[model samples]
Target: MRVDSRTLPLVPLLLGPVGALQLPLLGGSSSASQAPIAADKPLISSPLLQEQVKAENLMQRARQLYKIAELGEGEYNHPTRVIGSKGHLGTLDYIYSTLTNLGDYYTVSNQSFPAVTGNVFESRLVLGHTVPESATAMSLTPPTKHKEPVYGQLVAVANLGCDASDYPSDLDGAIAFISRGQCPFGTKSELAGKAGAVAAVIYNNEKGDMSGTLGTPSPDHVATFGLSDTDAAPFLEQLHKGEKVDGIAYVDAIVESISTTNIIAQTTGGDPDNCVMLGGHSDSVGEGPGINDDGSGSLTLLELATLLTEFRVNNCVRFAWWAAEEEGLLGSDYYVSVLTAAENKKIRLFMDYDMLASPNFAYQVYNATNALNPVGSEELRDLYVEFYEAHDLNYTFIPFDGRSDYDAFIRNGIPGGGIATGAEGVKTVTEQGMFGGVAGEWYDPCYHQLCDTVANLNLTAWEWNTKLVAHSIATYAKSFDGFPKRVEETSISSFAEEPKYHGPFLRQ
Candidate 1:
């Protein structure tokens, strides 16, 4: 996630006025004593092309979109390339091109936001409990200019690693040495500020490199240098022995304002009174072309949009291509915040497609019961089960961890669900055994790395998953009123409920 907790506002309501409708009952003649046979409608065995003129047209357009996206496979992070403008400008261009090409298909709206880029690093501490070599800052750490070493007394406090309450008010002039146990680095910094600490030193509770951001600065204070536990243990021990500890946390302030876009397109001739939104981030990470990371989801929706454009949808369908997903779901979050209460009421669902195609990977569904996290939605669970059975596809369900765009939509009470192909570093044993791929491998070897290129893409995997997304999207778009049937909501307690173990997803 790029930006922490920041979000763009939603576009104003631009949908046209709804017209009135009327339904009438025709008179029937009295029947004789003879029994009558009823007409058996043909099964909807295949995609109905004639009835789905729009779907066919969309598919035709999708074929073109897919080709264009293929050309952009390794270009996800190129500023001059198709995916470079991950923040806003690029999203606007894509949306503009589609809207302009579609002309009267639907109204187009643009929402603007500020882009902030900061130093992001992963600090690593050596295996030893007291080795300096074990501790290193993330590569993206900002250059600390030649400034005086800011020092203070080191204070070790539990639960203060990332929340605002972790820091003590009396430690205003002291250095706070905290433990990295739960939450994110950004969160730890937020807590440090509340504790009145001048600088924060976070040590690892467990052995491993710590990757994430040291929270962004508030208007009141600046946070810098989230240290590894191994590196800070010596000083922290001294503090524990009533000895004062001091160190520097220098930060070269880098802040900039930039623009990004949200590409939105809608279908015509549907129940304009209600609408459903399907979307994914169009931007990739700063490193590689996000061909698999998100280009899969973005392209899948693009293709789905192409199909929906020509089909006569029963409900209004809005296709959104968001920017800055790598930045903490900013684009989609912004879109959600800006919707009026009335606008929100009209939304039927929000289905997000993110990283839908991994070369050869498990098909995982989000929204399931877990012994750890209790975020499973029964309505969504059944819908996925039904879809899989209807399509004769195999899938596995995992607990939702609020990691994707669906979080924002669900926050507003909109039912949401989608698919994932896979990614590096999280593959299942079954996937390797069946697909002849690496077992115990990352779902994607190139995730967030420089190697996430077109060559790394698995075309077969992409095609199969793309079809799955298209089918689900089309199914939901056509039958919004009948899907995501309501399910029981459960409360979240401690983390014990979340499943710590991993299993095969999308395996037969």
Candidate 2:
């Protein structure tokens, strides 16, 4: 998911909101009506499990879901399945219908919540004599456009405008020429505004045009625009040669509070007090259909839920399809916030799956053992490592920085771990040697863009990761012998704050 920290008033739960009242409620009723299992039958038989959950079977089901998502885009004008849109709603319905048809094996319900949505209507940056070269506005930037093309003399700031002293004394009436590096776009723009500049233009230090967040809003912020190196080179050269350069930057946008829903399903069989929860975000960014970003993960869970009904689980398994995760983990946070102390204790461990298939892929496990070692997190991490080693496949570790939907669970003192292929971050030489993909290219070249369609998926990564997800469900759902037991006094304050704004280009 991308970093967008614009905080608006959260609308109440689905019970309080009328917009969510329109969505179809799928799945069986609560577990109170579930029939008791006979004690004579085995909780789960190993021989019966092998017959189901084959990789081929799972992959075929996943591909079918992908086709459903592809068809969802046909009903919408834009090529996206973003939350609160018709395309996303269609995807949600597909999940609900597929599970509800499984005859009484699972109990499902929809948990709705409110979110604030933002979209850019118009954004442009005219740098030189001609109309502005191609540019895009940063996410969550305030909508401000000059009615009369307000002009300012361009003045380059020192040190990429990361520090307060980088702003020049003469930048009062001019546009601050800040390069994107060392800090977030919000910080640079805020500092420029504090220095009395009318606006700020940040050019990328890398190859592409800048497209990122200012993290969150601040009072000391001006209208900010991002430009690529190719677009800003000539202007920088002219300014260095002591020639005056003037330009106009304009932005128009809309931010509003909206309502969305999260779908939660649980098994009717198994011990409810010792539940194993697994999940992924159901919503996508506004840019594309997000088939690979999380469609891969969400569908994997759906396929597993459908197939798991063929056998019985010893422990309860809950599947959650979170909403508005790209909007700063809102859906999951609300879900956790409302949990009673007993409900929180019932969850044994939570595993999250996101972006399981990137075109240029590396098998990545959440680094719970080494980096962010929560209580039972290490045992969860070792499960993936053991799975990869036993299969003779290569895998690496990614920091547990709380960048995905898992953030809410870990922050609430719930032990969590999961798998991810990769996102906008580039692959290293070592990762290339292990995974056989381009070293410097992004794992998903189409991440968070309009190009992240069905064609951009890596089927090999998708298949393998889906198999691992199945293995996790089957293994833990059957027993929790070696896993750590939940402690009553686990403090929520023990975990540190979720890591801040580590985007693709800003990885340290």
The best candidate by TM-score is 2
| TM-score, one value per model | 0.69, 0.78
After superposition on all C-alphas, the RMSD of every candidate to the true structure, in Å, is 11.8, 6.3
Best by lDDT: 2
Q: What is the C-alpha lDDT of each candidate?
A: 0.52, 0.74
lDDT of 1 by residue, 323-380 (tens): 6566556678778788776666566667777776566566677763323222323455
lDDT of 2 by residue, 134-188 (tens): 5677665666634233468888999879898999998987789998876778889
RMSD of 1: 11.8
Ten-residue stretch with the least lDDT total in model 1: 499-508
